[model samples]
Target: MKQDTALSERPAVGATPTGPDPERAAPRYTGGQIRNILIGLMLAMLTSMLTNSIVGTALPTIIGELGGQDKLAWVASASLLTMTATTPLWGKLSDIYGRKPLFQVSLVIFIASSVAAGFSTDISWLIGARLLQGVGMGGLVSLPQIILGDVVEPRERGRYSGYLGAVFGVSTVAGPLLGGFLVDSPLGWRWCFFITVPLAVVSFGVIQWLLRMPAHERTANKIDWWGATCIVGSAAAVMLLLSLGGKEFAWNSPVTYLFIVVALVLAVSGVFAERRAEDPIMAPRLFRNPTFVLAGLASLLVGVSMFGVMIYFPQYLQIVKGMSPTASGLMTLPLVVGMLSASISSGMLVSRTGKWKIYPVAGMLLVSAGFGVLSLLQVHSSIALVGTGVGLIGLGLGLSMQILILATQNALDRADMAAGTSAVTFFRNLGGAIGVSAFGAIMTNSFSSGFRSVGAEAIAAGASPDELAVAATGSPAAIHALPDAVRELVLGAFNDAMHHVYVVGAPVALAAFVVVLFLRPTPLRSHT
Candidate 1:
């Protein structure tokens, strides 16, 4: 493969050859080449980000059709498991092999998975497709940052990163509307999977043409395959417990305890494997750095709060408040606006002023405050009120999303750039997976409890105990199909469960606020 002149050129004096921001004499790609590459990268980013959350509003409809309401959280959990497992590997391999090939290969994986998911006839097939999609997503999300580091200097990257964040925000906005429309229309939820294929094809062509990398001499080090496998094993164990413990079996049951033991053993083994690997996925050493540790923790908390809300708000609108899928998605526009605006404006501000500490601190506080607002949500809340509540979360997340990664990158040495970046990203996704599943467990439990607690008069009004039990775990359609008094009971139960979830989980955001308070401030490096 032909190499770019700047990419292949020798590193400037005193610069690390693989530094996140090498001392470049000029950009590797210029003018329209740069623009097209970025357009490809941004569009690729959108494909994953858009697909990730688009299903939130339509999830109920899909479950209703698939007849697997009990498996609701697993739909999200399966993808999260594989993505979290594979994110670090993608970057590590990219360092050894060229970024372009891995990127193109990942896109192909994504496109193939999307097609597979579109044709799924049951929940198992859908979940399997999601797992495959996660494998591809691991690359799409990680490589752009690695490649951007390859091409752009740190100072100028802020503006471009802002544009990337904007793509995230815009996609966040567009996906739900599109997903809801697709589900509500003749296309059905299947189209949600089908929609990504063409955009991915365009991205595949763009990256193949415009994106280039210096030909990397393959690393002689063994590829830490054991460590990666162990990590995936432990992660999958934890996800299984989180998604299944309380719902599928009693938390104290033999099944739950057995899985817990298995997870702990695997996690311990994964840690030991990492310590011994020649090319460890995430060096055990990063934990020793206070900055690295704190950043990862903060990122984890933000993930829990951000993703927890992302999963539930649409459910609240559609299930508790009786909005159609399309209408529920439309209700989320305010949130999209807040997040997109905050991300773009904050990116510009940081690029120009070279200050970033205050943003995440501010963002975490807003997130906690937003969680407080969501805690007050009710079965009868107005659409405007729900929108305002969720908008705060979007605002807080937008401000911190790019800044946290930037902060972690600033704290690490050039050689550890990939490790540090992947670590932070990994924790963020792991937290999301655990948080969404954990909260889903809690909400579902509360749903059952709430149903049982309804007054005898309501139950006596002709709702079967078994039927109400099924309603607790089933879709909105199931709940709505019940008799009048039982329908009210079910809606009331759902609303209460929603309220309980936010109230119980809001403390994690506050914990993030405390952690962000301790993030060491470093001087923002100008592009050298």
Candidate 2:
């Protein structure tokens, strides 16, 4: 296979090429070769995504054994902070060094950290291991998309991206069920961490054996260390603020103000450093592209709806409907099915037509509609109604998720491919983090309000205020065990709280739809 000149060469700093070289063409691979490489990449993605979900399901068991209840939230927060912070750095490094080697390094890091996590003797140890694993997970998440941009034409990339989306959907569904089984069986929660190790190892081997790409040639090897540091620092500060604001410190506290100041300072420093560096981590030039800007904004907003629902919907099932965790997981099958179907079908349609804008436009609309539908759910809404609302949300996500990245890649110069791809991913992640925090605050306030209203009624009915308060804050099982009238009041409060969350989400999704409308539909490129 002949390597394209674009693949081997980097544009000089601040140079903007008008378009791809007409005389040069991308490296060609047989369909089987592409499929084989995708198999390895998908395995790597499955390993990364599955581990996060599995750990989420097993957290209760882990806390029981480790006895660090105070540190329980850090187990997840540590990884997310690192992963989001390092995402762009991995992409920039891949653009400088080449994707194959950096991806392999990430696999090694993930595998090692997974082993460390499984062997952890305490909560602190597990959090440390998870933080390390997140650095690797960042690469696993972003590099595959960049690599795909390198090997496949943007016109045909959707078909393959859909496959990756399917892998994500499967992992989302399988991880919790598998984690529960492990926790209940003699294998225990440790196996949740241990199980991903072999899968990642196999993926590492397969990528080594099958993945090949041309090395990137650069005129200078200077790294923008200052820019990287500031970017990471800024991202970490923001994440910490969002993760801990309402829980650990008041939103108006000095800690919150300190984090805000640190983030802003680092962010300003990063921008200035990028403008001065010989080789910037996130090039300033990419922002000039309208496709990149709009796509990134749309992705950020879509992420708000996506993660907010995924986090809160299960609470509705368990708390309001009194379903167990395992049963709630099963009930989400409609969402999985809708996502898988929409992703694969939309990808195929885009590949066949070479036109991509309609899907996202329609997708965001459906997401807004889904939010509206979900807002209508009540304490005793039928199972079918709940499924319909979630299914709509899943379908909307499927249609928009990869397509935004695809549009951004298609619009960028080959030299900016990795950085541009990572930028969009970073936005999506940042949005999810922000959405989770903001929506949680909203839920807390709404729940409080609902509880007070219902508490007044319970008091009038001769229910003790202290018992009502305990039931309001208690676990789903505990709430279900309350007296019938009090239980109804608690469930009603929860249902109203969820309604408020979804109602707010609907407008966010609609805002994303409005953003998507401004995207200029550039024709998909036939070659990388």
Candidate 3:
């Protein structure tokens, strides 16, 4: 018999089946069906991971063509803001509806946005499409893990989860390359958006044909509209606060203060709404599990370190070490390699040993140590040294990422799995958005402070304030175009500011290191 989408309480693995019903003894997946389903899921997983990194190298070109030189950062920020806010809703909806329709809907939305984005004639148009694209990306990011958990047992999920990590590696490693090449070619930057359309279509077809679950018999399932509204509102407010504050508006400005208050109010209201909700989108019971709480914290802190490195490290190389945009992206490849190898290795080991606690603990320590090493990098640092430092952090991420998911999933019953997974992902992505904004603010403030003396001396010597200001806030090319003496000073300022950013982040990583030690050593269940 097929299981209902709103899953019933089932026997724990190795326990006796309830009531000896003949249909309850059937295996979850037929062998042939399982292969097709996993392949379908892998494609959906690839699209989301690919979307994140694909436009990285092309963003400058995209903004250049679209005439959004001043609004360059919003290109990426828009997608992240929407995706992070919508994730929990996707997970909860899959619980109420079957996974296939929701997943397919997301694929359609993503493809349509990609098509729209490719045709964008202005920055506002492109940002609007990307914001819509995030709605799809949200589902892509969360639902694959939930679907895999639906099909695979906890002990076995590592192998599949490692595949997700592998796609993450491949995507990060290759996305910039593809984007750069396409942007440089006559096909131009728009092709970057066009490329994913075909992939999305294939993913949609594969999912529709191969992915199936029992239609959620929704006789008793009620949508918690108030809880949903408050959670999404609060999340949107928080993301907006992170993305806009200190950049568009002062940190202490009325806009910032208003959002802070709005987010807090909605969040409190959401919590109360959830408590009384018949089918809470966020289960209160999940938080009661120490594993879920610790794992959520670990995911959040890990996200900060992860996004912080991705955002600042490239700029560090380009400005401080005088590498080109392409080279800076390529220089980060070792991080991808380390992450892929470690994630797959840890996954396999966990499956074989059925033990996972030590990986995250050790991984967090490595992350802290890596960030500490990153703090020590100088303008004169060699590429090999940079790779070593970044690779350590990547290895830590590989070890920690999937393990945290597994830890949280193992703690939950069947009904809570989707919500639990979404909650973890939401926090992690939320951390990334916050990390980008906070660290960007740090970089900007530090650069200004570091350049103050340089700027004063230059003005004293008769250079234009406009020129110096452009050098301080401009792109790598602009900075490099300055006079030799001014260029060197600008470079030093960037190097110092980035180094300080890493130092500030090291303690945050250490906090994650400390938190993971408290994770209870729960035994892995090999069967669902």
Candidate 4:
């Protein structure tokens, strides 16, 4: 029988002589597709994080060699800026253009950029390559959710999302260590970028060979070019202001005010465009759900605290605690372990019980505890204790982050899956940019003040403040070559500077805890 109408909300089917009827479509994901997709996705996620984390350990060397010490944050922030800005656009494009092409395109771009980034002779070139790389990286993170949504029902996704968390945990654990070893063992830092090239090629080949998805029927409609421009402009402008405020200019500077105005105007225009556009870049409707809104806010806070703090931990160990880069990388194992264990365990538990709301409650509490403890860390504190504090933060993060995405997907209609996931990702990235900029600012200011306080004693003893300031960062080879007394003074200044940063970060983390507590309890729906 040929169906004249859609069958049970599925696509229409064939008709027969006896009667015209509709047929229910089989599930989109079958056994082969499921297994292959999982393999491809895991590899993709693993490679992405591994690449990002590996670069963190090598950044100091890369920036120093290129003579753009002031542009260090740009290497990271530029990547993040593009990644955050384009993630939502990728999601929307995936929905319209299909995931396979977009996913493969991202991999190709990332690999190409990785190769180019390695060959760069200066920080500006490196930063530009990194920025280009983010376009690809953004797709890597965004498409997995869309593909999974298309195949798996909401309830089943919790378990699979757990797999992603595990991948993230492992990458976080392994990346810096691997990077540290490579940088220290005569390979130099460029290999950090080169290393991802082969893996990316393999990932792309595997995905092309093994993965297939239903082709999307692209509709004829005007793309929201204006909306996208506004959104991207707004995000970039705001992040730029945040990053440069306390570094390149004073908080009250005219340049800062101009950027602030630009951000506000673009943001306002984006809101207007989204409301009027037939198809929007960032759907405002998602924010209509209070739970989604609250959860998004929470995710933002999590991103801010998590990325801002963890990214600096290696510097702290190398600088204040006087550990080698490799040793500092090793010290992060506890945090990654905690993150992996908690993420995997909590994911399985949520799948089993279909109860997820309470984990965030507990996770946020632990995060607050971790941050509070971390603020107390000094040059004299036990390395093990510092590790324990990071583990606590990881535990909280592992529980709360993925669950929020799961919850948001569950709450939305299946048709809205891409938008919902992108919304969460967007806010989290925004929060991360803000966190890194704000915290980095605090650290810089504190460093200057701390150095001033310690300068007299340091100079009286024969070391200059300039030398001490350079040593406080600890990653530069020049720092390693300094006299022991000068190095000690630098380390002391670094410890004091970090103490100030941590103290401020702790309160922000605590605020996340308070917000999570108020999130309404909701059941984990198996299907949206």
Q: lDDT of all the models against the reference?
A: 0.77, 0.85, 0.81, 0.76
- The C-alpha RMSD of each candidate to the native structure, in angstroms, is 3.5, 2.7, 3.6, 4.8
Per-residue accuracy of model 4 over 1-528 as CA lDDT, tens digit each: 122121134321111112243222324555566767777887777777787889987887787789788888788667777888788788777666666787888898998888889999888899999999888888887777666665566556777787776777788768988888888878799999888777777778877875543434564267888898998889888878876677777888899989989999999999999999887877788778877887888889888988877777777887677677778777878787878888878888887888888888788888878877887887679877898888998898888888888887777655456777887888888888788887887787787787677677777777766766565554546555567776666667777777777777777777877777776767766553
Off by over 4 Å in 3: 1-36, 68-71, 457-466
Candidate 4 structure, TM-score to reference:
0.88
Query: Alpha carbon lDDT of residue 237, candidate 4?
Result: 89
How far off is residue 444 in model 3, in Å? 0.7
Scored by TM-score, the top model is 2
| True-vs-predicted CA distance for residue 298, candidate 3, Å | 0.9
Off by over 4 Å in 2: 1-23, 215-219, 459-466
Question: How high a TM-score does candidate 1 get?
Answer: 0.88
Which sections of candidate 1 miss by over 4 Å? 1-3, 10-28, 31-33, 54-76, 120-126, 171-173, 184-189, 460-474, 477-490
Worst 10 residues of 4 by lDDT: 10-19
Superior candidate under TM-score, 1 versus 2: 2
Model 2 Cα lDDT, one tens digit per residue, 216-333: 4553468889999999999999999988788878999999999999999999999999999998999899999999999999989987898898877888998999988888888878
Instruction: Quote the lDDT for 187 in model 1.
Output: 83
Instruction: Give the C-alpha miss distance for residue 407 in model 4, angstroms.
Output: 0.9
Q: How accurate is candidate 1 locally (lDDT)?
A: 0.77
lDDT of 1 at 198: 86
The positional error of residue 387 in candidate 1, measured at the CA in angstroms, is 2.2
What TM-score fits each model?
Answer: 0.88, 0.95, 0.92, 0.88
Better model by TM-score, 2 or 3? Answer: 2
> What C-alpha lDDT, on a 0 to 100 scale, does residue 513 get in candidate 4?
72
